[model samples]
Target: MTKIKICGIKTLNDALAAIDAGTDYLGFNFYSKGVRFIEKEVCAEITSVLKREHPKIKLVGVFVNSSVDEVKNILDTCSLDLAQLHGDETPEIFAQLVPHAFKAFRGVPTDITGYEHKDGPAFLVDAAVKGMYGGSGVTADWSAAAELAKKYPLLLAGGLTPENVADAVRQSQPLGRGRCLRS
Candidate 1:
């Protein structure tokens, strides 16, 4: 079965709703400038409840352009199970966060070189927006994503909703889908 992840969780209510809805993963946007940005304390509160109430839900912390220490600190403080790196970090930096890190790309790459990371970290392909990290409400390139999906186990984000999720899945054939909770 395809995995479903709900991203941009900001409150205990939203977190619980997603978990109750049978989501496999919950993403907390820690990017300071993101539209769905959640404070460290709030994330902790939500995670605390989820861990106690719904231990099966996995928590993923989203970061953009942050250092290794910054990501590590937040991951530990928030008790996150995985880190989604969505910035300009090199593969080497990704290596440092290996086994606990995944990369979110800005749409499909012009060149397919090195798209796959060795030994760790799956891929998340989102819409390519200038000066934006994620949650832009813009649709991603599904045709291109479809091709890449065959090559990599990716999470397709950007402009996915209940209405279009099936189509997105049909076109892209990603390993799973990633969503953001509005509330």
Candidate 2:
């Protein structure tokens, strides 16, 4: 079965809702400039409750152009299980967070060249919206993602909705789907 991850979780209510909906992972956006950005204290409070109530659910911290120290600090402070590097983070930075971190690409890459992690979701593919890191509401390149999926364990994000999810799955064949539920 394909795993489901609900990104941009800002409140305990949203987190619980995603868990109730059978989501496998919950993403907390830490990019301060992003619309869905959540404070570290708020995320910590939410994650703490989740760890006790829903240990099976994995927690991921989403960062964009943040320093390795910042990511590490947040991960430890927030009790996050993994990190999702969604900006132009270097391979060196990725290496430092190996096994605990995965990269999120704006679009389909020609190859997984420097992002060869042996654990977790591996990589996430999001829409390549100009000047935007994610949650662009634009559909990802499913055709291109299909080709990339053949090589990597991909998590497809970007314009996914209940209506088009089946088709997205059929076309991209990703290991899972990541979505930011907005209300």
Candidate 3:
């Protein structure tokens, strides 16, 4: 089955609701620019709660081009199952960080150059805004994503909703290969 990751989780109530709805991953935005940004203390609280109450739900820390030390600091404080790089981070950065934690790279339509780091973690293909990270609520070219799926474990994350997830999965699936679609 394709994994479902619900992004922009802000409150404990919302997190629980998403978990109850069977979401495989819960994303917490650490980027200060995002409206969904949660304080470190709040993140710690949420992470602790999730660990004790809903251990199965994976916690993902959404970050921009933050330093390795900064990322490590956040991960050390929270129970993050993965770190999503949504900025201009290089493959080398990902390689160096992958050993410390699970890594995911966010890409836009033009960014899908079929170039991926050997040691990089998963790829999250999201809609790219001019001056913003994800949560754009826009749709990416599914055809391009379909083509990229053959090589990488592509996770579709742009403009996905309950209504369109099934179709996205069906259209993006490449025969025996599987791609992930996230909202």
lDDT of 3 by residue, 1-183 (tens): 566677777778878888887777788888898777878789889889999999887787878888888887898898787787777777666666674433333443445343354432347776556676677777655666777666766567767766876777777752211112233
lDDT of 2 by residue, 50-161 (tens): 9999999999999999999999999999999999999999888899998899999999877667788778788999999999999999999998999988877889998999
Q: Number of clashes in model 2?
A: 0
How good is model 3 by TM-score? 0.83
Off by over 4 Å in 3: 99-121, 174-183
Tell how far residue 105 is off in model 1, in angstroms.
0.6
- Segments of candidate 2 deviating more than 4 angstroms: none
Write down the worst ten-residue block by lDDT for model 1: 112-121
User: TM-score of predicted model 2?
Assistant: 0.97
Preferred candidate (lDDT higher): 1 or 2: 2
What global local distance difference test value does model 2 have?
Answer: 0.93
- Deviation in Å, model 1, residue 142 alpha carbon: 1.0
Better of 2 and 3 by TM-score: 2
